[model samples]
Target: MTELDPVIHTPARLRIMTALNEALEDGDEIAFPALQKLLDMTAGNLTSHLAKLEDAGYIVVAKTFAGRKPVTRVAMTPAGRGAFRAYRTALLDILGGSR
Candidate 1:
């Protein structure tokens, strides 16, 4: 049996990773506000989950200015993509065993 990634196994984190994996193309990023809206998570809740993913080296959060306004962007790192793939495989394996 394969071990699941505890960091991504949490429901919120799982949703975050899945969203990133599905939404992003290579080298593309999503605006923080857009991601929050898509996930339907409160700003604080999204930030908290983002911190966990960042700590795990699974995502990058960049804050910069768009003209005079502050803008935040999020992107999955290569390591994150690989981790997500592994997590998906582990989940599939677990489900496969039940049949």
Candidate 2:
């Protein structure tokens, strides 16, 4: 198995993608605070990477009014999921996963 080339893989972006991929596994929407806490990232940091992901059509951001407050949720798109799976597989291949 071939590894994913670093040309399209960045550490920070990979972290963001991994987080979204984990969230999808549990059938729950990811909230900003929750994601921030999980990633231990600042708002600015997250925004920059999220912008890249959003621009790539890998994730969708939904905004809604929760009574008086606004709710923002991030969900991985199908394309995102597929890409993440491939990325994971490639990474494992690079690591030579135990058979």
Query: Which candidate ranks first by TM-score, i.e. highest?
Result: 1
Tens-digit lDDT string for candidate 1 (1-99): 789999999999999999999999879999999999999999999999999999999999999998999999999999999999999988889888432
Candidate 1 positional error at 97, Å: 7.3
Cα-based RMSD of candidate 2: 2.6
Q: Which candidate achieves the best lDDT against the true structure? A: 1
Looking at model 2, report the run of 10 residues with the lowest lDDT sum: 1-10
Task: Give the per-residue lDDT digits (tens) of candidate 2, residues 1-99.
Answer: 586835228887788888788766644579877888889999889878887887787788778888999987888888878788787778778898842
Question: Using alpha carbons, what is the TM-score of model 1?
Answer: 0.95
Error of 2 at 91 (Å): 2.0
TM of each candidate vs. truth: 0.95, 0.80
Off by over 4 Å in 1: 97-99
Indicate the TM-score of model 2: 0.80
- Global lDDT for candidate 1? 0.96
